[model samples]
Target: MAIDDRVGQAGSGVRRDLRDALAVLAATPRLLVALDFDGTLAPVVDDPEKARATPEASRAVERLIALADTRVALVSGRALKDLEQVAPFGDEVLLVGSHGIELRLDEADDVLALDADERQQLGVLEQVLDQMAGTLDSVWIEPKPAGFAVHTRLASERHSRVAHLVAINELKAEAPDATVRLGKDVIEFSVRSTTKGEAVEHLRRYTHASAVFYAGDDVTDEDAFVALTADDLGLKSGVGPTAADHRVAGPAEVASVLSLLATLREAHAADAPDTN
Candidate 1:
């Protein structure tokens, strides 16, 4: 319940509160472990394409995937195609990309379709972002299926501020009703409305999970954190401002959390009676 709040730690370095929470979560009839990709599972990098999950994190997720009644997922702000290129585990982990606008449930999942009006709105959004980004150095635009994100991670302080300000104003003028979200050094605009919170709710209902574990690392992640019910656990990775009830240092600590959950879940599954 209390994630980042300091409490006594065991020899394992995990807080007593977290360990107790995990123990309870592991015993639930169904569990959903959903996470944000960037900065949560993979370390945030200047070049988003090169990002990958840490070795320990990969092993931890694999372990969870092997357990019965447990579903693991990576919910991210990146477009599904871009996310697929950098994120680990392929179909082994369920994916909610484009801030929940896209879902890859299985190999047979249908692609997202844009109607005529939505397609027109996206075209206008992309053009505004690309043109605004073209005017600045080290500022670039990333295209998504329903919208685009303006990345200023590589820009100088002045250029970054300018990029963000210009993008916000332009989107306001061009796509007045579009969904706009600001993240760490990134400003995103989408014609279709969605959020990580929506993604979490979707996953929870889809899996019929009695308990959920969610971790994230950015402001956009607040959406997901707030979506969590009391029965769910929210861990914030890295720091700044967050709605998450618990906090972990960064991707490494996140790996530890996952590994711990995997271990606890493994034991619980073993002790579960054979219903067959």
Candidate 2:
């Protein structure tokens, strides 16, 4: 369906709520806008490495970055390096990956360091995931800095369930302290305990943002949504039960939201009286 058709399906109440959220974001002195990568800014593809932001979304992001006092960030479950390969935005935008365990701020890069024990545990996780992948057709394991992810997007329902069960059980037995997160057709195991919520809070403090706007599409993003304050806005890109204040159809709608925010912020900046 066309973007306009999808947008037209939104109820009046949702439109009003989105308008109100954009108003608060536009008026804030410093604004932080964080978005999830796959399935939020970009359509989730069969091959994770092939994912890229839609052209419309990319243009909207550029506009947001150009706005004064507005900071844009992509907080994703992919590794920082992998996210960089896909998005490839300039230093003006922040990139948080591996669910906040890895951060690339401006020109500096920060990653979670694993101790000897954690390294050993991660090796075991990789072995277990490899074995599970071997057993299940179309299931693949993605290695990460802290741990690994089992992707079942292309697997049959039965195979996906069995693979996830095996991986989860193995992780519980081998790396009992590992942080496990379940999302759409994927299961991730990491040694670090960081969450997207923590990442959002960190960005908010780092940027000294008066208000924040966060959007995502997966269950993993619920953490970020819950972290939002009264002054902040949370948008769920797709549907299901979510903690986000508003819901949009998919990445297309997300792009529209970004465009709306950029337009509103530009207007607010134009209307502001010059202090100098």
Candidate 3:
């Protein structure tokens, strides 16, 4: 499936049903669960570092991991090392970090190398952003191991707008080889040719998931949601116009849906006959 060209209205009963369907998919035998980290799994907080998975959500994810057929992936903007710090079950969930630029499973040192152009551009952008940082206050440039983010979240309302414009202009001109991307309060410049949509496609093939269910709350995550087919599920985390098939109130609601899924999985396991 291609990126959904149709950007639909954000709220509707139809959107709600999609979230309901995601709860159902969570119970299926072969599950490929992909989630965006920041505003989806953890609540949006003042300090990004304090953003940790809620205890209940973490526990539920652990239970879901216990299911033999389930495969979970944490797809996030953070670098692999940072993602590892906050994820619930260490190494249990496949970590697709740096906007899927790097992927790893069960090993810290283990990493999937990014494409050649991405490798070269990332090096150049790192230096350029650092030099421009002093001029852009509240517009700090976050240097991930694999990529970089220009954040305007801390900027005053007027400066926030200015910061975005300045960063976008600078990144485009300086990092000609990199992919410049826009998001909520941030602009990401990466060397990866592959977008989030492509990341989902790779995971679909790797896990052979019959149905793909992806959830996220940011603009960058829309690419993945748009990539979903009719059979797949795409859930939006907040109130807004989205390409996602489903919509939820917030992170707490996402946890509830996940918990319900675990219950359904346990019930299914109990019903299956044991050969032993």
Off by over 4 Å in 1: 1-11
Residue 193 miss distance in model 2 (angstroms): 1.4
Total backbone collisions, model 2 = 0
Tens-place lDDT digits, model 3, residues 108-139? 54555666776777778877777766776667
Task: Rank the models by lDDT, top first.
Answer: 2, 1, 3
Residue pairs clashing, model 2: none
Q: Identify the runs in model 2 with alpha carbons over 4 angstroms from their true place.
A: 1-14
Candidate 1 accuracy as TM-score: 0.94
TM-score-wise, the better of 1 and 2 is: 1
Q: TM-score of the candidate numbered 2?
A: 0.92
lDDT of 2: 0.87
C-alpha lDDT of all candidate models, in order: 0.86, 0.87, 0.73
Q: Could you tell me the lDDT of residue 219 within candidate 1?
A: 93
Q: CA shift at 131, candidate 2, in angstroms?
A: 1.6
Cα TM-score per model:
0.94, 0.92, 0.84
